[model samples]
Target: MAAPNTSTSDLYRQWAATYDTDGNILQAVDDLQLANLLPSFVQNLRSSRPDGRLRVLDLGCGTGRNTKRLLLAPSSMPLEVTGIDTSEAMLAVALEKFPEATYHCLDPFSRSSPLPNDLRDSFDGLISTLVLEHLPSDVYFSTLVSLLVPGGRALVTNMHPDMGSRTGAGFKLGGDGVRVRGVSFAHGVQETIKAAQNAGLEILEAAREVEVDEEMIQRWKGKGLERTAQRAQKWIGVKVWYGVTVRKIGDRED
Candidate 1:
């Protein structure tokens, strides 16, 4: 089989229109997990910084789904969210949905300085869902560490490394029936942990989940995607996603 075209920005631009409605099971799982996990982090930040607004960076915030989630979450402190993505098309949809949040168009991999200097070590928390696989290891850890203040927390999620070989860690026809694929790189669990430690982040928690369940299988069957349902069934108990929470323990060198 030929490799799926992995042009990151172009592919997302083509897929942006249908991304939200794509009935993506993985995305659904991510949403649920993030919803459950984010509240505690936000609450902690709020308690620590009672006098000011909490700043958050949503890296690779495609269509702003996770960004909106963070904004909607009930918090004691106000949230100032800034979302960044390489594809203008993706950012356009996100901006439309949440005009209140700041959106930036930037190529994380190609840019020498992906974020503004003024924002360095300013964020109270950072969240990147299903985005890390697309970033180089050095860039991944360095950018994450740079954006967070010491003692700030971060949540990073990606397709499980074990499933990357099977699924290429790349995009396919999302639930919306768009035939688009973006480039992705595979990094193992140990590699991710090591990167965080090397960047002076203290790992708080790590989890892996098998997103496919009977409910998801039935939903696929209802949509008349029998093959997809079968594929989902085959992996019912197999882990397909990984999430990690780490805290910045030291100040950025720069």
Candidate 2:
């Protein structure tokens, strides 16, 4: 029998222990994709705010995976960054790595609860990486809409549905590890765009799909991630992830 899937909370709680060290190839690929978009996002965000301070949100900022790089990226505007997550355990790890940033938790069980007033439509930019595949399309984009200022830009990356349909946002357990996936919803690129549009956001840039290739396989092998290298072999020439740059499209009640 296939191992039972772990609950989202349980999966992240346990996964947090080794999340960063696990040599996750998806994160490596995602980091590059998001990194390419950061300069534009930072520059555009700062231009919109006169004080030259960039208020950025790392929505689903897991284990500071992308946050560390964002904090380190060269930016003329000083950044005021905050992170939100559904797992306290994961948040604890993030805090340990990035004590300078503020962190908040939204009850995963009560996702409908609104964020604090100060957070509503408050950010100049947002980054959500490798997270959307695990969420229902509406919930994911709606949450992004809530966190951005009108006209704010966000860079969102996710496991391509082609890939998510095979595997999802999950990791193998600590030992003889059983792979555990959270609730993964298949979301095609058009479906994602449609959901965002419905949530009052518009795609500023079309989806950029990334495929696995031989260089990635060799890179993983060089990193001592033999298992990851082996896995990528099966995915070569496959679209593994996609990203889109978007902006909040309409006026929203803050």
Candidate 3:
């Protein structure tokens, strides 16, 4: 299969219109994986400050599906939260869902482009869900480091290249499908910790899990005989979700 070189911003803008209503919306395999992962991260933050609010940032927040979970109860926070995404359309949906929080439509991943100076290192905690895999290897580390303040915590999750399906598998071309131009890096537990460590972010916890929904599996099987799916289930779990909480330990000057 020929790899497509589609811009993340453009692809998301196209996807935003129907993202929430898609079959893989509420209990989607990927969404469910994230829903399970974030609460643990929140609990870690609460442990640090038992009786105070913690600032948080949700980067590459698409339509706020994963981000919304943080805004809802038991995972709810007693702090200010902000989200940034490259697609305004997706951000619009996020805005509708969580009008109380601020949302920015910008590419925070660009090294040359910084978030508004005031927002720099302004958050106490940060989380990026289903977003890191979209970035190239070097950009991934740079983006994480640039966004953190000293002692701030970050939790980032991405599609597991070794297990979960890559961008644009079942969908048709130019039809709001995922776009991945070959694998720049395999996003797994070790790489996530290593990236944060290289960025001077200390890892507090790291784990990987795969939960395959029988419905999604049947859907794929009906579409075609996906050998990757078959091979993965033989040994590896179907869904690949990873969560890492890290803190910035070094001075910014270094």
Best by lDDT: 2
User: Considering every candidate listed, which one attains the maximal TM-score?
Assistant: 2
Per-residue lDDT, model 2, residue 1, is 22
Q: What are the per-residue Cα lDDT tens digits for candidate 3 across 1-254?
A: 44465566765665678665544321245555666667777777677666667767888787887677777636344657788888899899999888877888888877677667867767667888767767765577667666777777787666666553443212223434443342234566676677667777787764655556556466545755354345335433445555566787855321
Q: What TM-score goes with each of the models?
A: 0.85, 0.91, 0.76
| Whole-model lDDT values for every prediction | 0.76, 0.80, 0.64
**Local accuracy of candidate 1 as per-residue lDDT tens digits, 128-207:** 99888777776788888887888788989887766665664334454434345567777788888898889888998765
Let me know the TM-score candidate 3 reaches against the reference structure.
Answer: 0.76
Per-residue lDDT, model 3, residue 132, is 70
Better of 1 and 3 by lDDT: 1
Candidate 1 root-mean-square deviation in Å: 3.6
Question: What would the C-alpha RMSD of candidate 2 be, to one decimal place?
Answer: 2.3
Error of 3 at 177 (Å): 9.4
1-254 per-residue lDDT for model 2 (tens digits): 23677777777888888888776668767866766777777777677675657789888886887787678777775688888888888999999988877888774224667677898878878998877887788888888888788888898888888888888777777634677777777689899889989998888887999999998788777877787787577788888889998999755323
Predicted structure 2, TM vs. truth: 0.91
